[model samples]
Target: MSVEEEDCPPLLETCAGERGNEDDDSDGWDEMEVSGEQTTCLFCPLQFHTIAVALDHCRSDHNFDLLSLKAKYDMDCYSYIKMINYIRLQKPHPKILTESSVALWEDDVYLKPGDMETWLMYDFDDLGSAPSTPHYAIDGKAPISNLSFSDLQRQIQELTIQLKHKDMLLENCHKDMEHMRKVTKTIVDSGDSLNKKIPNNVISSGCDSSDYFNSYSHFGIHHDMLNDAVRTEGYRDAIYKNIKMFAGKIVLDVGCGTGILSMFSARAGAEKVIGVDQSEVLYKAMDIIRENNLQDKIHLIKGQLERVNLPEDKVDIIISEWMGYFLLFEGMLDSVIHARDTFLKPDGLILPNRCNISIVGVDDIDRYNKVVNFWDDVYGFSMKCMKSEVLREAFVEIVPPEKVITNSVILTEIDIRTCDVNACIFSSTFTLSAHKDGMLTAIAGYFDTFFDLETEVRFSTGPHATRTHWQQTLFYLPDTIVVKKGDRLEGTVSCTRLTKNVRGLSVTITIGKNKYHYSLD
Candidate 1:
């Protein structure tokens, strides 16, 4: 910034330091009574040659964006008032003018609109000064000591460089924040896209409908099944006697309705127990844990074993009461086998290690005549058409020991640890001899379960033993077969899961060139 010596104010000296021959002039400068206005900044000690140059210096170096200044520096209205007073160096205004006018700047009283960008937001105090008499530098300039003004140029240069450096850092910080926001938005969008990409069939498979879930989710139907002493006591005794297998071990209970088996595991000193079921009955099972105060030891999950994630990666024991009508009617064994393959440890044991499906020849003449013959006539009228439909289905009812005409034969044996779902679809050949000849009405079937305990605990639901919920499944022959004493009756019984109803069974009987097909719904 250069100043011509001719235009310099008489009260302030023009720099002539290097002009060796120039007169060292201080004629009318030192003793001048300065007005403390122009020729020097009222806020700082920096001097300028003219009022216009001083105003330009104020705008270029000291003026700030009002909104950005307050936000970035955490300033309030009072700080802005101090700043405005420091810029203008007039008496602090204590009152405000609400109205705007074109003459406000032109008049000698009011502040000019040229500085309104920074001053508008701050409350301007009047301090009883009249608007017709505004303050401005007339002939006198604001006074400054020569010692403070010596290094003014160097101070302004250093401050300008610092401001530029701060601007660069602030810009970089904003760029980083914007980049993080975009990355977060992209991750959220990807998760929603993955959910939309899933197939409808897979989504529907998780819910229960009439096909497989409704019948099993109804816990009321299985209340009696769980209470059956013949079925439940066998499991309770087997678990209680073998504490070594369960003590300090991790156990997984598949299809754990009411969580009875899981309670047994907890009582047997298991380190951890996980009981899982996909049925709505699982809510009631949670109550059982609370009732027995076994919540700490046993954890129940309301989900299918095939899909539900277990707490442990591997288990030491897998216990479940998965037997259905006729042993494999509901195909619950499939779920147990799945848990075995997926979660069982290398040396883990499966409860009810083996199961035997027993078949016997029954001379249930009374039961046969009641079901098959009743449909043959309706109120003494010919209704033989219904008899064909009745014969196509099997009967699930209790049969007395006297009704069994032949000794029980093991149709098939299953090792629970190694069996799969396909093990239910089987063909078994049977041979039975009649000690006394009468009429062979139906082929009766039942099953016996065994755990590999020391004493070989056994439980059966056959006609020759105490009855269970699964009374006995009877496959009635269409035509009654006559047999003499000591005569042998031989046939192959093919039991399969029906395609239409997954929880139902279908039986095909082949005996003496006669083939009979019956479905149990």
Candidate 2:
């Protein structure tokens, strides 16, 4: 509370009269009506009731620095906050920023910067009071004080609407909490019995949780993913071209979404093919097999590969399209490994015998603009909160090759034929020499899969290749680093399987002093 008496020395009569009510209106001052004879400062002792006259006294006599007011608030958008303009016939308050928040308003509408240039009026009243803090923060909340009689009436109407919204959210959260409690109770009760939880103990022990995979069974997610030509065609190419391997062979399709690979093997002259999927979509696979009249050759198993019993003792070939983002994100590869070890014949072959993972430096100016920098001035307010949250999260999307600003480096290669599930987690150091001068913003990961050694049939989920269901994973840097065309950027990227949630993954990348952590959620 910085208050003073006679703080603004009186001005000369002629000078004050020249800068009167007309001047006040021109300087964007809207104040309470006062008589010409009522010349004393209405709010504080100074010279006149007109805001223009009082402002003149403060500016010339009192030394009220406008720049200091801005610096006090660390305000960049000065045009939106007119603290002095809102005060009626009084000098600028020293603690305006500490006492109140300033917002742009016009004709009862809140305005943001870069909006209409006119209608820059101000309102200082707000009492029909809801505590300026969240209404749910405490049991008793009061609205802030200082509103005109008319403004108070309008504010009360607004608070009523907000209170209803808060109540609805509280109710929904309570319901969800109750449901989770029941689920917890069921797990605790089962633990007391010490009995085996399921028929297949391996799957239960190996998987942290299968709830993430259960989502694929709903709606048309699995069906839509199956329709992606880049994914389905790769398996189609591998199975058909290896008909020599499939001829008179017993094949197994692990985690088969719709039995597409099984049908391909059956049509390729396989003696029999077993297709297993734990999703409800498996029911549709039965219909597909019947319509294709391949029931004689393809058998559909509707359970997890680890739990389900295979009709045949062993299979000559096992084919599965189990790759996820970054080649191992979904954790389905573990199930494939289990099926192979338990049921495959000693000479059995895996469809994708080899896979190569790759990483590259990216410019990605367009993506950064959309996801990060756009929040710098959302509707004129500093929506910096969104920018901070996005910086901490990983983005999974199809990245174009043109966005890569440097040469790619091979992170690691996997011979899925000989590679165990635990071997999927890996790390590599890369030296990315800049292809062109640009600000490197992020690092992206991609992988290429090989089907066979005979024909070398393979496809890439790389930026340089056609679109695939397994889109590239982008880890945005905490801060962009500028590089010359030939400058080399050295960094290490380590990817790990999160044992707590098998479907989840954590990737850490380091460049210079900046380190970033991202995850597939």
Task: Residues 1-521, candidate 2: write the lDDT tens digits.
Answer: 11331242232222123334543434312222211332333235654533334435655554543344445445343332333333221122333223322221111111212211111212212111253222111222112232244544544455566777789878977876786689678877766455724322112112122475577667477666777887788888877776687899999988777778889999999999888887766777777888999888888877667776788999998888888888878757888788878988898898887788898888988888888888889889989877767876778897777888999899888877776765555556788999899989888898998887466688988899888777888888768889889999877776654434556676667776565767776
Q: How many residue pairs clash in all the candidates, one count each?
A: 9, 4
- Displacement of residue 105 (Cα, Å) in model 1 is 99
Q: What is the number of residue pairs that collide in model 1?
A: 9
> Where is the poorest 10-residue window by lDDT in model 2?
103-112
| lDDT of all predictions | 0.68, 0.65
What TM-score, over all chains together, does every model reach?
A: 0.60, 0.59
lDDT of the structure predicted as candidate 1: 0.68
